[model samples]
Target: MTTTTRTIPAIADQIVLVTGGARGLGRAITEAFLREGARVVIDYVTSADAAAEIVAAHPGRAVAVRGDVRDRAQVEALFAAGREAFGAPVTTVVNNALADFSFNGDARAKADEIDFPAFAGQFASAVQGALHTVQAALPGFDEAGSGRVINVGTNLFQYPVVPYHDYTAAKAALLSLTRTFSADLGPRGVTVNMVSGGLLRTTDASAATPDAVFDAIAAGTPLLSVTTPAEFADAILFFASPWSRAITGQNLVVDGGLVKD
Candidate 1:
């Protein structure tokens, strides 16, 4: 089918859903969209208080819903909740949910020690979770005649600076899905892309990272700084905005120039 012809909506006109949006890097992404005046639906499996507080802060522009992205039924309900709150279908979706994981490389299982289940758990969160979200968002996209899918990724897949194997592998799979989904959905005016960031300086997931590791990453980067969630969120905004209308199936790294590719 030919992509329906329509004007790209401004960021303020978009209704956005961010999975795992109550805390950490996800919270940063949620705030970034709201700052642009977009109505936001914050999805969380926990962190209800945090999510509610965010919604309270934004008044009518933001709402929080609890759902697990790995489940299809819950994902559909998430969209319904968004529509109920905003009176519009979600025009953008940010699949940023991650399973329980920490960034302490010292505590990580080496290749020989890491089990298949570890990879499976990560895949469920990173790849399967994204799959459920995209599938659920498809109807809304078809209805609106356009949509944006921004998958949160990691720079480790490219650089493997610390090799958190399972987590990095799952993100890599998600990237492959990003390109394929773009090809399949582009005809319907949907764009699928990824924004990969390195170990964010202070996200909950990265809290376990030692100061020396952080400093080393900063030292290795051309900018001599570790990427922050807010900085990474800015790139996510770029993909969701009208300026990126023609771009799809691509990965943009926002790691302070640490990974050149």
Candidate 2:
């Protein structure tokens, strides 16, 4: 008898759908996937020009689609559009779209000051959006009998450094969904996971964060530097690869060791 290990599939063989992939951390993730030869669908609620540029840069390997993840119809249509453009089903889905937000700790609402509307809005974007995408992608997963779902998360739930209360709460719910979804989908040959990142050094959301804060974060981290969107994006790829076939319902934090968990 001989024993052999399964190797991860090449990115070129995977068709991926990335939400909010037109800019910020999503852009980095899309580019990384493209570089690895993956056929990518960049889903954007706005940022038309940015999405166009990414598609242009990648030529036939990438396409940009407009969709609001919070809207179930739009999400379904987005997946349809991807299939139409690529002539293949999307085997991987990355839920990286964030609700509109700025990382200005000074301007963030304190717990007592935060309102129900704020929480509701974040939940719509973080939790509801994931639900829409996952539900939309299920038929594809069923047809293929295999699929990958990588949800973008945040380290703030574990290490509430500045306590962006609403954002953190929504992501906490997303983590719960990650676990439950994995359990439900595991038997079907689908894997669900999360890649949580601390405040990235330079992204549109974090652009308002003070330079001093970035420096302080770098000094405290084991890596002695603030993590970049590109670095965080790389961690997302691991969850989507065949190497992670047996690993589901896990949250991998990519923040230069800022949070021990």
Candidate 3:
């Protein structure tokens, strides 16, 4: 066997802020950025203590700010705090903030439990959060002449096996926004993309999932295994790197071939 190493340039000097980086998938995304030598900032709503723990581990390499993505003022404050901590003009941002998605009681949700208002709440956090972050960072991106925004998405929109009407609808709108933003920002050297993956086990977001549900998904997928958060982070790093310089307005799925579309 031959030894091989990734050649991606060190982004140690670059600052990357991840929304909801206290634990689970968001934490993994944040760590991936740190591993790439990038100064990392994490934003969270209720995970401040957890965020503090991450900061303690990384020292100056990581900073965590408290804020709720659903609230515009909180979002603004979060970015402002991050700017003061890590300097102005953030270069890379990964919109991985999402409302808790652990299954409440069933593999599928009843329409009555989550209505239109609930759906709106989901969109407010996912799509609007991306919109707010992109808007807040665009001036910086324009001044710098280059930047990257990677939105975290789900694969539920492909087939809609379960009625995650709220979550799935919000993500679908997010997917549309990712593409539209890419077209609008492409001319400015700002790349926008979405990384959608299947139900990932070994994460808090999927913790409440039933065992039968896990087996169902694992057996249906071509890989016959659950996708790990760290593995999904690899795909995120790709879109954020120079290797994907020419790639944008695309949804890269890492769902183990569960759905071809």
Relative to the true structure, how large is the alpha-carbon lDDT of every model? 0.94, 0.92, 0.82
Q: How would the candidate models be sorted by lDDT, starting from the highest?
A: 1, 2, 3
Weakest 10 consecutive residues, lDDT, candidate 2?
2-11
Kindly indicate the candidate among 1 and 3 with the higher lDDT: 1
Question: What overall lDDT, based on C-alpha atoms, would model 1 receive against the true structure?
Answer: 0.94
lDDT of 2 by residue, 160-228 (tens): 889999999999999999999999998777889999999998999999999999999999999999999
Poorest stretch of ten by lDDT in candidate 3? 2-11
lDDT of 2 at 146: 85
Question: Candidate 1 lDDT, tens digit per residue, 1-261?
Answer: 644565668899999999999999999999999999999999999899999999999999999999998888999999999999888899999999999999998999999899999999999999999999998999998888899999999988889988899999999999999999999988889999999999899999999999998999999989999998999999999999999999999999999999988
lDDT of 3 by residue, 1-261 (tens): 853332323366567879988888899998888888887879988888888998898887888888777777877776677678877667788999988666534654687665577788888889889988888888777766688899999888996656678898999999999999999988778889999988887788788877787788889889997788999998988888878877789998888888797
**lDDT comparing candidate 2 with the true structure:** 0.92
> Candidate 3, TM-score vs. the true structure?
0.91
Give the residue spans of candidate 1 off by over 4 A.
Answer: 1-5
For model 2, the stretches where C-alpha displacement exceeds 4 angstroms are: 1-8
